[model samples]
Target chain A: MLQIMEGSHAVAEAVKLSRPQVVSAYPITPQTHIVERLAEIVADGELDADYICVESEFSALSSCLGASAAGSRVYSATTSQGLAFMAEVVFNVAGMRLPIVMTIANRSLGAPLSIWNDQQDSLFLRDSGWMQLYAEDAQEAMDLHFIAYKAAENHEVLLPAFVCFDGFILTHTFEPVDIPKQEEIDAYLPAFNPYQRLDAKDPISFGMYATPDYYQEFRYEINAAMTRAKKVLREAGAEFGEMFGRDYSGLVEEYRLDDADTAIVAMGSVCGTIKDAVDEMRDDGKKVGLLKLRSFRPFPYEDVRTALAGVSNVAVLEKNINIGSRMLGAVGLEVKDAVYKNGTPVYSYVGGLGGRDIRRKDVKMITEWAETGRNDCFFGLREEVL
Target chain B: MGIFLRELRIHGRGGQGSVTAAELIATAAFKSKIYSQAFPAFGVERRGAPVQAFVRFDDKKVRLRSQIYEPDYIIVQDSTLIGDVNVFGGMKKGGIAIINTEKEIEGVPDGVKLVKIDATSIALEILGLPIENTTLMGAFAAATGEIEIHALEESLRERFPGSLGDKNVAAAKKAYEIVKGGL
Candidate 1:
């Protein structure tokens, strides 16, 4: 049914429909409303589940790892430092092949503390063997959880997944969303029938210590699983659309890219604003559009290349910087490589870090920069702030 | 497209339900068959600290996710925060400012109509608290006419139930009546 709700609550409502047996989390700064609502759902007997309150994000995922290892469809959520704190287990969950679905309300990490929206947190775990999916709005954020669980648990794609939406930007906003019915979700995502399980009757040691000889193969198998997930996600996404009328089958969504002279490739909530900017620019006779990336991991290079086949140039507007990489933004680096063969110049326009608002004018300015052969740099910098 | 595109910026102290007021306004607008979205520009969230929340109402889906820098309407939950922040900084001409105050504020933005109400007193009278979010929502509905009073009432009642909810509805309705009569 269509209803108005906070983005976090929307994800929570969807998570409730996922019906995991164990929902574990640590309530701290950035303790998103998703966890609170999930706890309430469990406490009120609305969802039959065990809500584990842990001391740290470390314990949070560790508990999820244990619960999943012991044969229960489990869930967890974290961001920024919490995800960093649980780093060891983040890799272990995938290495052990636990198909746990974790929602990441993406926030920036801190030496200078920030409780704001950014993609840096999720990007930090890019190599953690977890399949990463980014959503542009609350509705997409809510729907992707089901898709995450479906794909992660696929026999060929037995891997953990992070369903990421911008922290405060997407998490706290209120908007209209068509929440799927419980029965509809149930039909889409069946009960968790584990492909591998640990039971008292059949004791099994998962994540057994592999010497260097076996360790290399473990990495290969995990990479193979990540590679296979592209298809699994498409199947899961197509199945979701068949049932829900919203398609997520395409790895990258092309928004008015056909015959476009310039393209802005981006992910997460910022894509919505980019679409609005693109509309306004098109009105002004600018041949511009957006290529929104839905899947960052198992990087869809082929899809991205196809999407931007003939763009004059591309402005890769992202929320995270790669410290000192030649191409600054994390997503742009790969985007540069994808379009390298086409001789398309991909300008890295990294802005919106730590919650700096990216208005419509900035989008137009970046488009001009891409067209004029302006040097690629961090698009916006406050001279006084420096 | 009754309202083609209307943006609202709400200013209040932290812990004063500014974000809640924006949400209820959005919910009320949604109930009226309008597409609305709301979010906050939170700053630490400590009580008595200045904070801003925003709402956008449009005939089509409201998909712009950036914070509102320019607004067509302004709602000031506290008059004192005027010195702390520019409550009417980017208000468009011919826009309206619904403020919770008993006296007229200085430096009302050029060409913007100001609607002043003693929302705190109204809230304290009915709910026995200084929280004027519900009252201001009433004043906002009356001043702007972008949302129907009854639709606002429905959201208020649903958000806050029982006698507390009834009292909030009463406070909002009273403010609504005052603003409506003044207009």
Candidate 2:
């Protein structure tokens, strides 16, 4: 049934339907509602799962790691500084090869202390070996969680996953989403079966300290598994589409790129605005398209290359800046890497940082600039006083 | 789907039901079978601050998620919220605007269709509170003619679940009659 619901509530509902055996979460703004609803579900016996109320975000992930290592499907969520607090455990979950799926309500970190939406929290952990997927809206946020769980738990890709949604934007916004019945979700995702566990009867040590001799191979194996996750993401996303009438491109979702002269590369909520801008631009005879990154961690380089290969020009919009690089990180540079040999110029934009509103007109203007083949461009900024 | 995907900009001081009104609107929308998304954009998260909540709804699944920069319709719960942020920014050209204060909407900006009601008075008469969220929904139904007043009442019942729902439904009905009478 269609129901009016906030982004966080949608995520909580998806988590319930996913049927995680263990859930541990520490409350933080924008992210709190997800856990609150989950806790209520557990308390009311609406969901048959253990809801561990932890004192901090760090413990939340740590407890999930324990549950997952013990062959139980584990879930947890956090935002901004709460995620930062759990950063160490984030890397641990991946290294231990625990198929834990986490929801990150993407928010800006604070010094002047803001609880608003931004990509900094999740971006900081971009290299943590967890497959990160950025969701553009509530429906995608909820759907991506299901996909993330399936991909992470695949035997060939037993890596942790973090499905991110913009704080307050998707987290607090209400929209109609199809809540797949629990039985449907169950049919799509099988019960968790651990490849190996710390069973007392079988007694095996996990995460043992490795010296320089063996550490490199262990690291290589993790990287190898991540590479495998890219294909697994594609297959699982296709499977998700077939099961529930929604099609997911897995690594990236492309819109109107075929025969387009210029394009915008972006992740998360801003893509929706860009899509609107692109549609308007197209109506006015501008060949503009949008390339939205779904799988950010495994980077999805090959898919990105294929998507942008035909466009005459491409511009990447980064919500979080690497500060002082004067270059786009991750998605921007990756797109450049994909098309550089083909001679197509790709521009990079660092915009919408710290929750500064990114508008559609800004996207239109940037796309117009890219068509001219300039070195690069910025959007929505006052002209430099210099 | 009781969820009416509406992006509402409420203009009120710290104490009014702007954020609460947004939440109630979302709760009521959810009750309607449409998914309602509501949130206040407050720097301090303080009361008496300028606040806004965005909502989106569709009979089908909604995928393009972000703040409703472009609203199909806008409800200004407090007439005061008009000048704080760009309440009219990104509103559809022929979209609906429902306001609370007694000011004639004709004096307001011209772009989208505007509807004004004495939401405060409606609240006073029905719920005995100056907070005009429930009352405004009635005006919202009248102006936009999107969701039926009965749907809003059903939404209130689902959200409040007690006498609170009963009072809100009464406020909605009274406000609905006033809005319909004007039309």
Candidate 3:
């Protein structure tokens, strides 16, 4: 049935349906509502799970890793500073090959202490060997939880997954969502069955110290598993689309790119705004399009190249900037590398950091600059403030 | 405006229930079988700090996720925010501004309609407090005709419940009648 609910509640409902055995999380803004709702459901006996109130974000993820290694499906959530605090455990969980699904309500890292939305935190952990899936809206965020669990628990691809949604923008917004039924979700994602276990009867070592002889091979296996996870993601997305009505079968979703000369590539909730701008620009006789990168990790390099193969001009609108690099924004740097063989000019435009609004005008201006081959710069920068 | 997509921005201080008002409006629109969404501008706002909330209504699923830069209607829950913030920024031409003030406000942009209601007085008289969020929903229904008065009242009752719900419903109904009577 359709019901009006906040984005956080929708994610909670999806998690409830996924039937995670253990949920551990510490409270953080934007992410608090998700864990709070889960806590309520657990306390009310609606969801039969252990809702652990850990003292800190590090403990929260560490506890999740412990539960997952013990052959229990586990879940957790965190944001900017909280995610930063748990960075050590985050890398450890993936290295241990535990299939823990975490919700990253993307927020900006602080020096000025801002509790606002940005992609800095998740993008910063791009090298942590976890599959990163960015959600464009509440519905996608809810659905991706199912996909994340399904793909993570696959024995062939036993890697952790991060389902990221924009802080406040997608987390606080209320919308009418068609939440899936428990049986439907069960049909799509089965019960957790672990390939490796920590039972005393047949005990096996996990996360032992790797010497120089075996460390490189273990890292190579992780990279190999990550490559296999890309295929697993597509299968899970296709199965989810068949069960539910939304198709997320691709690493990148193409919007009106078939006949366009220019395109803007983005991720998360900003893609929705870019789509709106693209529609308006199309109506005004401008040949523009959008390529929404749904999966940022495993880096979808081939799919991105194919999607932008026809467009002469491409713009990467990113929320996180690589402060010390010449390429500036992370997404732009990756896109430039992906299409370097095609010799396509990729413009790096950074905007919407720390909850700054990226309106239609900003998108239009950035796309126009890309059309003119403008290079690295921040959109909507207040020069006077500098 | 009644049939097309409509956007609304509500300006209020923290603790004045502006966010709740936006939710209630969207709920009322949903009750009327219209696709709608509501969300508050998330910030570290303390009590009595200036805040903003937004609502969108459409004939289909509302997919735009950006904040409302242009709104067809504006609701000022705290009249004092008029000078402190640009309450009327990017308001559509011939748009409506439903303000919760007894005294008339000045400098409303030309071609935009203005409707005033003493919602604080109505809340105090009917609900025994100065929570005018529900009361302003009544004015929104009366001025815009986008949502029915019964839908707004039903939403209020469902939100508050019991005697508190009854008091809020009475307050909303009184404001609805006042605004409908051209007050």
Rank candidates by DockQ, best first.
Answer: 1, 3, 2
Position A260, candidate 1: lDDT? 99
lDDT of 1 by residue, A215-333 (tens): 99999999999999999998899999999999999989999899899999999988888999998988888899999999999899999999999898999897998987888888998
In model 3 chain A, which range of ten residues has the least summed lDDT? A377-386
Off by over 4 Å in 2: A382-386, B1-8, B20-39, B55-74, B79-97, B102-107, B110-116
- Candidate 2 chain A weakest lDDT stretch, 10 residues: A377-386
Q: Which stretches of candidate 1 lie over 4 Å from their true place?
A: B1-3
lDDT per residue as tens, model 3, A1-386: 88888899999999999999999999999799999999999999999999988899999999999899899999999999999999999999999999999999999999888888989999999999999999998999999999999999999899999999999998888888889998898889889999897888988978899999899898898899999988999999998898787998998999999999999999999988888889889989999999999999878899999999999999999899999999979998889999999999998899898889888889999999998888889987888976
* Candidate maximizing DockQ: 1
Q: Report every candidate's CA lDDT.
A: 0.91, 0.79, 0.91
Looking at model 1, the pairs that clash are: none
User: By DockQ thresholds, what CAPRI class is model 3?
Assistant: medium
The candidates' DockQ values read 0.67, 0.39, 0.63
lDDT of 1: 0.91
| Tens-digit lDDT string for candidate 3 (B21-135) | 8988998998889999999988787899999999999998776777887889999998999988999999989899999998879989988999999899999998889999988
